[model samples]
Target: RGLFPSFFREAQRREVLLEDLLYVSSAFERIAEATEEMLAEMEDSLRKPVDPEEFRHFWLALAEDLEREL
Candidate 1:
């Protein structure tokens, strides 16, 4: 299976250029929202401030998820 799933089939007609890009953009937004939620959960569990190293892991995961979703 493709890592980034196509949102539409080839048989479907495109009425306007860049219309499909909107769908992909929305999917990316969802991916970002999920990442933010996961990070928030981690933040909630921590008594001390989140360290730079820990934040880097969270950011890398977000980027990876966005790449896959896109």
Candidate 2:
């Protein structure tokens, strides 16, 4: 069984090629990288002393950036 059996079956019926799968795999990698970077920034912020309002703004901005990426 595959992760998305129906979708995979449809894709196979459509004769989807390896390159198409690779392209989607790469896109997912990019999204994962962005998420990791955002989490690292948040972790660093927590390690340091920051003003409450400033931290809130920083967190919100990071969240927005992540939303845009996804």
Q: How much is 63 displaced in model 1, in angstroms?
A: 36
List the candidate 1 regions with Cα displacement exceeding 4 Å. 1-17, 48-70
lDDT of 2 by residue, 1-70 (tens): 5669988888886666677788899999999999999999999977997799988999999999999999
lDDT of 1: 0.80
lDDT of 1 by residue, 23-64 (tens): 889999999999999999888877577699979999999999
Locate the minimum summed-lDDT window of 10 residues in model 2.
13-22
Taken over the whole model, the C-alpha lDDT of each candidate is: 0.80, 0.90
RMSD of each: 18.6, 14.6
